[model samples]
Target: MENAQAVAPKSANSKQNSARRHRFWKQFFTYLYMVILAIIVMYPVLITFITAFKDANVQAFVLDFGGKWTLVNFKNLFTQTLYGSWYLNTMIISVSCMVIQVIVVTLAGYVYSRYRFAGKKFSLMFFIIIQMVPTMAALTAYYVLANMLNALDHYWFLTAIYIGGGIPQNTWLMKGYFDNVPYDLDESAKLDGAGNFKIFWSIVLPLVKPMIAVQALWAFMSPVQDYLMAKFLLTSESHYTVAVGLQTFINNAQNQQVVLFSAGAILVAFPIAALFFYLQRFFVSGLLAGGSKG
Candidate 1:
């Protein structure tokens, strides 16, 4: 009986030790996986940052850490290239798209969520169908339409396309968010003689600021990151957005200003990174809450 009790304690200790080892390995592997992923993701960004600061004479593609660093790449990027104009053009398009998209999507969403209008279900379904069609499929149509309107190379025209292309999906997202807000607030506001616009602008809009921030961020980033649509539409170098303008640096063998491209790429990140950091608090919550309904 004494031997049995002593063996039981030893067995219990062994089992506890085994469980601890298992947990240790599990956590170790999980952390290892995260570290591996972080390295993979940060590698390009790190290399780009390194290359952007390296001497202009150094081979841009070679990953050399010991090379002398200079600010000439950035200096040439702004002075030699039309980077300033491209940056301004891109900012205009992005900001305009954000403003217009927010206003249109918010109104559409509020109407869809609060009103019982004719063909509402059909319209919503139509929006889903529109969303299913890839933007690439409509590129030819866009070009043709732009040609017909003589609006090729126009920033306003490109901005309109960005705004219109996003409307259907953004409307659905906004409507889903609007649905989560209580209707009692609208009723209570009505009792105080609040008009429809007053209820929407004052009461409901405040509730969905997170989603609006998400929409604005999305709208802002669309033109900033997009290469294909801008490349296809804008023929003039002067009219080009930063995405297209930056491509000109490396589009041909003779024009391959790799160092300048890297510098421009780094600078391009500033506005986006700033905006993201500003809106990040709302970004995850907005996406989650807005997507919850739809």
Candidate 2:
């Protein structure tokens, strides 16, 4: 019996050692994988930032920061190209789309949430399904329609298209947020002799500002960064967004101004990052709450 107890204790110690070793390896591998993924994800941004500061003599792939660094690329990007105009155009389109989209989506969401309407379920389902469809699938149709309206080169037309593209998803977001708001508020507003429009604009809209911020952020981003639709719709270089303007730097196979491109890319991230940071709280709350309730 003494020998048996001694052997059991030894066995337990061995098992404990094995478990500790197993856990150590497991955590090591998990952290290693995370580090590797972080590296992979950050590699492009790191390279872009590095290259943006590099001189013309430095190769794009050189990881050495001790080499020559110059701000000339960024200076040339503004002076030598239509980058300033492109930036202005992108801001105009993004802001225009954001304003129109927010107002329309807010009205639509309020109506859907507060009123009993025909084909409401079908409409909601259609919004969900249509959002799943890629905009590319209807690219030809949009082009044809733009041609029909003689608006192929018009900036207003492009902004309108951006607004339309953002509507489905934004509407769904607003509707999800509205679903969380209690109907008792609407009832209380009615008891105070408030109409549907008053209730929506004054009370309900204020309550759902988080979702509005989320929608506006998305609406603003789509136009500013969109390359495909902007490229297809706006043929005039003078009217090009920043994305299309950046593409011009690489079109020359013989002399690609990658340094300038990198600088421009770095500049592109500033507005997006700034906006996100500013709206971080509302954006995060809207996303999390909408996901849970929707």
Candidate 3:
């Protein structure tokens, strides 16, 4: 009996050590993976940052920053280039898209959430199908359509395209979130003699504000980042957005300054970073709300 008790204690200690070793490996691997991913993602941004501070002679990949640093690139962007016009155009387009998309997505989501109608499943299926089709496939068709409508080089044209293309995904996302919200809220509002639009506008809209913030941020960012589509549709340099404006600095005949490109990139990235910092909470809350329950 004394031998058996001693063996049992030894066996327990062995198991405990094995468990600790397993946990240590797991934690170590997780941290290692995170560090690797962070390095991969941040390295490019770090390179861009260094390029922003170096002279025209410095190679972007080199770690050396021995050359003179000047704010000439930024100065040109603000004072000499068409960057101001691009910024203004982008602002108008982004804000318009935000308002229109939110209003439409919220309405569509609320209606899909609260009401039962004919062909509901079919409608959703169609949206999924449309989303599956690549936008690049319809490039020729869209270009033709824009030209026919005389929408070339117009901000409103881009805004419409942004809003239209954005709806399907936003609709699906918002619908899922609205599903998590109890139907009883809608019913209670209706019981107060609130109509569909009223309940949607006053009750449902307010509750799903987090998703709206996320959607608006996305809408604002997409057109700003879009290069190919904007380049094709917007021919004139003066009507360009920041993304297109950045291309001009690269095409300069005298000096192909990587530093200028970097400075422009920094300027572009700052607004997105600032916006995300401000709305980071809403972004997290909104995503969690969709992933889990209401």
Question: Which candidate wins on TM-score?
Answer: 1
Candidate 2, residue 173: the lDDT equals 73
TM-score of each: 0.93, 0.90, 0.82
7-33: candidate 1 lDDT, tens digit per residue: 999999999999999999999999999
Better of 2 and 3 by lDDT: 2
What would the per-residue lDDT of candidate 3 be over residues 15-69, giving only the tens digit for each residue?
9999999999999999999999999998888888877877666644555556787
- Between prediction 1 and prediction 2, the one with superior lDDT is 1
Q: Which pairs in model 2 have colliding backbones?
A: none
The 0-to-1 C-alpha lDDT of every candidate, in the order given, reads 0.88, 0.86, 0.82
Model 2 alpha-carbon drift over 4 Å, by segment: 118-133, 277-294
Quick one: best lDDT, which candidate? Answer: 1
Clashes per model (N, Cα, C within 3 A): 0, 0, 0
Tens-digit lDDT track of model 2 for 1-294: 999988998999999999999999999999999999999988877888899899876655555668777899989888888888998989889999999998999888877777888999999899889888877788999899989999897888888878888788778778778988999999999999998779887988888887888788888899987999899999989899999999898789888888888899889897798888999988777878767866
Single out the weakest 10-residue window by summed lDDT for candidate 2.
Answer: 56-65
- For model 3, the stretches where C-alpha displacement exceeds 4 angstroms are 1-33, 57-61, 65-69, 251-255, 277-294
